[model samples]
Target chain A: MPVIKARVTVTLKNGVLDPQGKAIEHALDGLGFGGIGSVRQGKVFDVEIEGADKAKAEADLNAMCEKLLANTVIENYSVTLI
Target chain B: MKSAVVLLPGLNRDRDMIAALTKISGKAPVTVWQTDTEIPDVDLIAIPGGFSFGDYLRCGAIAARMPVMRAVAEKAAKGVQVVGVCNGFQILVEAGLLPGALMRNTSLKFVCREVKLEIANANTAFTRNYAAGQVIRCPVAHHDGNYFTDPETLARIEGEGQVVFRYAEGTNPNGSINDIAGIINEKGNVLGLMPHPENLIETAHGGNDGRALFESALGLPKAA
Candidate 1:
């Protein structure tokens, strides 16, 4: 099995509560920043794995997402394997 | 020393945490409901991991406003050892017990697994048993553990060595800048982490790393 890695990022899509991001926006406004369109908050995951086959690797990666990585509610997951 | 676990409606790990706590405390921790204003006299107050109030209104936002939290906050001001795990962590950040807030993962998902953490600063009361830079395993299960803080605040946390634990290597599990896993208050008494060490209490459960947390509490009571 070759050593593989997964780089994943999770973010609230647009128009979410994003209070943290919103707070930053308001803070920026308070700091006299102008024409600031918006702010969004998200997290990133860098994972390490060992696998022989690419197909199995993909399946395991998907399983990792479905079972643990992503909640599939109120958020979205994007995976990038390197 | 007496200790209590704050039990919010959606908190699912109260029993597990209490079970782990008993090993060091020599007695089970009291569970206090969210609606209650009074927190029993204890050396520490634990905000256990779980989907408090279904994680609505943001991860810990609603819990921070809970009545029990108000009491918790007051005691924390007096230097009480208030530890928050997962949802408890979110609540602490939401309540401003610790700096920074946990935002959605860049992938926007809930993560649950045994994670590797490097003990970043072990001088604090909660991490004194662990060696600095040593790595330990614990479970992290959360949707909003991406820790975010402004640059100046980040600098202060770093300068003051308030960060207690961080992800090992480049395993920036949640896109958390600095791979932060846990942080302590300015006084180093309170700790909040996205991982659930309480769930890793026994070897049968995978490991006994969680015991150290309670062990650190042995010499201290919940409050003055």
Candidate 2:
């Protein structure tokens, strides 16, 4: 069985307020970074699983995201195999 | 009435909740640990506030998936009364026992202060002692106390009288939608609120405004 690597990204859903992102946007403006349309903060997780089955690994990663990696209520998640 | 308090690591308010319950009910509440798969029979289950699992992934997100939470969910399903305060409220939402989600305060700062709370609906088991539209003082302390939900869900909850408490008198500390400070489940047995009612249940605490909530849930006569 080969080791499968994956990455999961989680971001706040649209229309949900992002206070941390807004703070960063303000800080960037203070630093003279101009013309920034907007800013949104998110989280990324790099995971490694020991398995030769790609489909099973993908399924497991999605399950992990649904159960723990991301809160589906206010956040969206994506999984990419590497 | 017999009561129990859920215990999880990084939670700092178990002692306060236990003391409040003990003082109010004249009996010490049993403490349930995070890994426990079964909870003893009790009338009320209270989950106190704190930075559970260090607020990893999200506030209350990690703790919500613990074994004890499954037991709590089971108890809630059976029509037993459940109350969650602060981070406890966050856990309930994360565990899918309650609607909506608590997010980072819109001010991006942790708020630890007193706020006025209005009894939006006094008909539930938790707020029966207070009159609808009555305002009381309670302390709220948290970084992610901002409550939010989709428009449809919000409308439904509002229409159903599930919105039990609201921040009143321009004291919405976390930018919660509709100034919501507390809410109950559709069945009205489960309640999750951001304020610390336990902290204000006695005259020594400066007021006993929060005592009636416990009295209501515990089926005790209204406090004199």
Candidate 3:
């Protein structure tokens, strides 16, 4: 079995309201970081799998994200395989 | 012994929870839908786990603002017991019944499994059946089970003993700090936990650890 490394990152799409990110940005502003423009919060998933094919792993990862990891509507995701 | 279980639109577990509670309480709890304008008399109020509002817009964020939830909040202000599980947990956090928000699991998976929970506080209505520092196994199925809170809030929760069920050591799975699996309000009336106790209430379920949770309210023995 070949071990495939995959990372899935979930981010709030532009025009979506990220309360957590906004809160962080506000805190930074309060800390005198006046130049802070914007921040979008997201989820990062790091998974290592044992498999023979990287392509199969990528497809499976996508399925997982669609069914569970990413909310699809509010969040956009990009998957990377190593 | 009379309890009411609120049913949010898209709430799929309300019936399952009702069965579990009825089996334990000897009476079916009343179900209050999200659009309802009234909350009847009941000793305990439960927000069952489900894809409320199709899990749209940050899990329970939308459902937290439902009309029935407003009523539930009013009841809670009078110290009525409120319990939320999974999506229900998200609702509690969104409703501010409990502190902190559930984020994506560090593993980024919709993990569904049986995991051990360390009962940190045995003094509350929900966990009184278990001994403090005791460990028990239960099931969890969720993607946003990762719990996060500010340092100050974390310290406060620890000092106040509001941290109830913590994940067994080194088994966080979700990257929750302090391995928190559940928490209660400062008053100990509202509880939010990620694990599905309703899934483990029967002897036929291969485990009966969850029976203790519902039984705790009635001061009954562990079903296992």
Per-candidate interface C-alpha RMSD? 11.1, 0.8, 9.5
- Residue-by-residue lDDT tens digits, candidate 3, B35-114: 88788988788889888888775789789878898898889899888889989998998777789878778666788888
Q: Order the candidate numbers by DockQ, best to worst.
A: 2, 3, 1
Any runs in candidate 1 off by more than 4 Å, and if so which? Answer: A1-82, B220-224
lDDT for model 2 comes to 0.96
lDDT of 3 by residue, A10-78 (tens): 886665445568777888999999898898777789999898788888899999777566655446898
Candidate 3, residue A35: Cα displacement in angstroms equals: 22
DockQ numbers for every candidate? 0.02, 0.85, 0.03
TM-score per candidate, in order? 0.72, 0.99, 0.73
Where is model 2 more than 4 Å wrong at Cα? none
lDDT value, candidate 3, whole model: 0.84
Looking at candidate 3, what is the lDDT of residue B144?
Answer: 83
Candidate 2 local lDDT, B73-165, one digit each (tens): 999999999999999999999999999999999998899999999999999999999999999999999999999999999999999999999
Quote the TM-score that chain A achieves in each candidate: 0.75, 0.96, 0.90
